[model samples]
Target: MISGALGAAIVATLAILYGRALFTPPSEIDGEPLVAGAARVLYVIDGDTLQIEQQQPTGVVRRRVRLIGIDTPELGRTDAPLKAATADQPFAREAAELLRQLTAEREVRLELDRRRRDRYGRSLAYLYVDKRLVQEELLRRGLAVVDAFPGDSASMAKRLEIAEQDARKHQRGQWQKQ
Candidate 1:
């Protein structure tokens, strides 16, 4: 059996490591913040994904950005037969529509986390529009659930969790009883 002292020390070490990895602020390079630039949202692909035209020092670049700390229902997939669901997932359209209304053609700031890209090569970020956090809004409306990854922002995850709880308590959007 593991000793109590050793287990406590191990847990403490793990917590410290996790906190550093997930809560570290965005880095600065040459006295400028790395993700300080703003991007115009070309389109919202879904509730949590967007295509953006970002203005960089070199030129304008278009990229797909996946929102951090939240997940909405998936839209229908006709292209992939493996996950073959012809119909959209529950509340998918509502989520997508709300996202579109929130960000379409608007300038949004992308705040990046430690893991900058997902496996699919989409930029991972916390999207903000006019200083409003889109993820928190979605969670508050019950349109999304907290789906933070290990390297995503810990503070953001906490905020999202609270929003989701409030949504559930009031039975808003997808949380409404059928």
Candidate 2:
């Protein structure tokens, strides 16, 4: 077995080499404060939701982020909000699959909008993987619908609408039935 001191030294060296990579600030993504609200995506709950962990002065904070301005088909649960079967929505699994591929085990940057939280208190924000906006990509792929919530800004709403239109014209994702 390795000596205790030697093991500890190895761990310390690894931490020193990899610490910043693990706890990257949002601004470090592609530079600029525009990458603010950086966090590690712990996991994805659905196409439009993620569990993210961010460091704060007090400690690390973990919260669910809801991608605003777009809505994917519901993945209903027996005890969920007005619980019912959501499997009926076309491309429901496909959307969730795509979301998982995009966000699982990745670090993401959050850009908050006019509203910061949803009805369930989930952080309402746009997610960026690398420097690419996740919301706009989802809309472009036709995996999401522009379900504008009351708190969503007019400008963002318009942009989502335009993306949806493009997706529709191209017969992408939901626009094309399986």
Candidate 3:
């Protein structure tokens, strides 16, 4: 009986240790430093996110990146006019398609500001393609709305505000009249 009790204690201790290791926070790991500069887009996840590949000590690392300062409407969100009217095709689908056409397998530059990976482990980056900012493109095309997060750099914030103004004035993409 004593041996069984001892074994159970050992098992409990081991379980606790293993659980702690498995759920270790990012702050605990010596996370890869925030990388900036140029990279190539391997794929586009949506209007505001893409997967980019960059060189690292362990060969090339691919990062799933979410664009800062933009939030596109959901594919079937009731707030989306296009989705409300069309039962067949949703605006989110169209935006994703557009992003794929623009960024898939293309070279882009990335700029990192405050945080690196979001809670979900996706890298948060400001992307540029063909000398134009990707966030601006989404806004200009009316695919996404400007939604700046805290800790954004001054210049980037200004640029995003300008892009949003442009989109609003022109009523591009989803901003267009119904």
Candidate 4:
């Protein structure tokens, strides 16, 4: 058993080391229902995900945001913990390249849904660059497919679905006949 003096010393050290984290309030995004703001894109993680930096009172906060209502071809995964590695899908590179070219180090407008974040903790948002929805561009180019969820905006989902259908009909990008 620790002496009273030793136990007090240990507690004091822990409090000094971790007090801020234990007492500071959570960020606004953690509790907000909807988040609408502009952020600078730090990098494109994939066709439908990006890292962005937003200004916060404490400092700049970097976050990963996943686009809503769309899914792009998967990039190859060489490092899997519990499953076999997988190869890139047919249009994976093209999709990722397109997204990178469009959003890298650029300012983007973010409009989040009522369900601000997904199960992965990445913000779910619709990103816009120069007033054009990036998701629609991906769909029109056949780089991504409509992947609407219950949380997605109904009208936007419909629009994305139409864009995807048109791309498919025109045999664009990933929809090209093999």
Question: Could you estimate the TM-score for every candidate?
Answer: 0.76, 0.71, 0.70, 0.78
List the lowest-lDDT window of 10 residues for candidate 2. 26-35
lDDT comparison, 3 vs 4, better candidate: 4
- Model 3 scores a TM of 0.70
lDDT string, candidate 3, 1-178, tens digits: 4698899999999999889878754323435554787788877766677777786664566667888878776554355666554332345776788778777677878888887767787788888777888788887877888787777787788887888788889988877888
Compose the digit string of candidate 1's lDDT tens values, residues 1-178. 8899999999999999878767642221122223545889888898899877776675556677888888999888788767755888888899999989988777888888898777886777898989889999999999999998886678888989999999999999899999
Off by over 4 Å in 2: 1-36, 78-88
All predictions: root-mean-square deviation over Cα? 14.0, 11.2, 7.1, 5.0
Task: List where candidate 3 sits over 4 angstroms from the true fold.
Answer: 1-34, 76-90
What clash pairs does model 2 have?
A: none
lDDT of 4 at 123: 80
Model 4 misses residue 94 by how many Å?
A: 0.9
Error of 1 at 84 (Å): 3.9
Per-candidate local distance difference test: 0.82, 0.77, 0.75, 0.83
Error of 3 at 148 (Å): 0.8
Poorest stretch of ten by lDDT in candidate 4? 25-34
Could you tell me how far off, in angstroms, the CA of residue 113 lies in candidate 4 after the best superposition? 1.9
**Backbone clash numbers for all candidates listed:** 0, 0, 0, 0
Q: How accurate is candidate 3 locally (lDDT)?
A: 0.75
Clashing pairs in 1: none
Top-TM-score structure, candidate number = 4
